[model samples]
Target: MQDHIVVLTGAGISAESGLSTFRDNGGLWEQHSVYDVATPEAFARNQELVLRFYNDRRRQLASAQPNRAHQLLAELEQRYRVTVVTQNVDDLHERGGASNVIHLHGELTKARSSKYPELVYDIGYRDINPGDTCDRGAQLRPHIVWFGEEVPMLDKAAEVVRTADHLLIVGTSLQVYPAAGLVYEVDRDVPITVIDPGEPASVSRARFIRKGAVEGVAEWVAHYL
Candidate 1:
């Protein structure tokens, strides 16, 4: 049986494929304040603004393609039991052919009912307007784990990490909590590799590949695997 290989990804990986992080280049996401579009208070004050912001993000996601790092990870699944736990809201991993993926930051291609969060719908290239409603007749909102919301998948992700024979982390700064803390969940004896251009925050023993996502992941995989 192949050893379970759990990989955790963040903005850096997707940024290689043209996806920008909310904190990139001086702490701003898409030239707008993160508070204006990503907070529940912002949504309450101006739903239209919030909806349009995500709509724009959705359009950008539609335009971007999976990069080398994404493709390589997909190929790794051929050799290992791969499970991708990503903080990206985009569907790049799925598009890149990663079969098992968990989105910690929710997804861009989905919308849920305001009344019932479970009533989510797959929205492909469609705009979520103000009047969009579910069976309960409540407005629809982006299926995203916005600021201040609890990540429902944290426990499951922790369990996955705890059992991994190898842990591969790519493109994240290890600054964000909950998701960032997950690295500690892996068995200390299990080997861990982190690939990134900038030096990511670390807890002793992680082998760091200091390079961009594509180059770093490829190099690390070649040297170690």
Candidate 2:
């Protein structure tokens, strides 16, 4: 049986593909504070503004392409049992050919019924208007797990991390809660590698490759693949 290789990725990997990071522009996303557009309260205060914000992001994602780092991880599936656990809402990993991925933060390509979270619909890159409703006649909202919301996939992600024979962390600062804590779930004996341009806190024992995702992943591939 092939060794299980679990990869944890973040916004920094997608930043190379021209997507904006959450911390960019003085913590403002597209000139709007995260509190103004990324919370359920914000959505309640101004549904149109929230909808427009995500619509813009969806349009941007439509133009973005998967970078080399995404491709490299997918390529690793040929030799290892690869499972990607990503904090990013983008679909680049899937588009790059990764067969198994767990989106910790939800997806931009889908919408869920505000009244029934289980009623999710795949909407592709299309803009969701104020009147968009699910079959149950409830307002449709972005499938994204907004700030102040629970990360439903956290437990499953931890389970995957615990089974990893090899753990790779790329492009995250390891500053976010729940997701950051996942690194500790891997067995102490498992080989761990972190690829990022900046120093991510909390994983002192993991081998560090201080380069951007594309370059760092390439280096890891050369050594391990």
What lDDT does each candidate get? 0.89, 0.94
Window of ten residues with lowest summed lDDT in model 1? 21-30
Error of 2 at 148 (Å): 0.9
Between which residue pairs do clashes occur in model 2?
A: none
TM-score of 2: 0.97
Q: Which digits, one per residue and each the tens of the lDDT, describe model 1 over residues 1-225?
A: 898888999999988888767777843475887788898888898999999988988998999999988988888887889999999999999999899998998999999987798999999757898999988899999999988888988999999999899899999999999899999998879989898888789757988889999999889778756
What are the per-residue Cα lDDT tens digits for candidate 2 across 1-225? Answer: 999999999988999998988875543466897888999999999999999989999999999999999999999989999999999999999999999999999999999998899999999999999989999999999999999999999999999999999999999999998899999999989999999998688586799999999999999999996
Report how far residue 135 has shifted in candidate 2, in Å: 0.7
- lDDT measured at residue 1 in model 1 versus the true structure, 0 to 100: 85
